[model samples]
Target: MIPTNLVVHQQSKVLELTYENGSTYCLPFELLRVLSPSAEVQGHGPGQETLQTGKRDVLITSLEPVGHYALKPTFSDGHDSGLFTWDYLYKLCENQEQLWLTHLEKLAAAGLDRDAPMTKQGHSCGSH
Candidate 1:
């Protein structure tokens, strides 16, 4: 399930992943950052997940491989904790559109904007 090739296009702000199955996925840096499977973003458990905002322009600065199963992407915003596992990455590619829409819904439900920072009184902001 590991990607055969992982290309980070900084200028385009996207990550192009090619799998062994000959499938390719073009994932935007923003999307990856927002949906990062890190404790910072996903929190420690269900219902504690944090919604990431204002990441529409984020970019991956570097991608370092972790063993032979995952990648650690350091984003321009300084977020590098999320380790994208092979299977996890494949899941992201498989459910791209639906996940995006769900994220959008979460944003709207919180009266937040994809292009705006989460600055409401008690909300945890992801701005860096």
Candidate 2:
């Protein structure tokens, strides 16, 4: 179920994945960024998931391979921890519509705008 081709369409802001079966999925950069599997986003346990907002314009600045099993994408917002595995990517392709709907619902429930800028969190100091 591994993709045979991966094309980054900067103009369209999507990552198009083509599999051997000829099925293709065009995943939006914003979706990838918001739904990233990084601990910063997903958190360390259940009920700790962070709702991502203001990511409608996010981009994939770079994509690097992680061995033969996954991909690591550096996002325009400086988030690069998510590791997208082949199986996980395939699932994303299959469930994108539902996932997007859910994201939108969460945003609405939280009274957040998808196009608004994300407020900086944590310390005021620049030190990480």
Taking the candidates one at a time, how many backbone clashes does each contain?
Answer: 0, 0
- Which pairs of residues collide in candidate 1? none
lDDT of 1: 0.87
RMSD to the hidden true structure, all candidates: 3.1, 2.5
lDDT of 2: 0.88
TM-score, prediction 1: 0.90
Q: Residue 115 of model 2: what lDDT?
A: 83
Worst 10-residue lDDT window for candidate 1 reads 119-128
Please provide, for model 2 over 1-128, each residue's C-alpha lDDT reduced to its tens digit, 9 standing for 90 to 100: 79999999989999999999999999999999988988777777786677888788788999999999999999988889899999988989999999999989988988988887777655323435
**Candidate 2: deviation at residue 42, Å?**
0.6
Worst 10 residues of 2 by lDDT: 119-128
Candidate 1 residue-wise lDDT, 12-42, digit = tens: 8889999888999999899999999988789
Per-residue error for 114 in candidate 1, Å, reads 0.7
Local distance difference test scores for all models = 0.87, 0.88
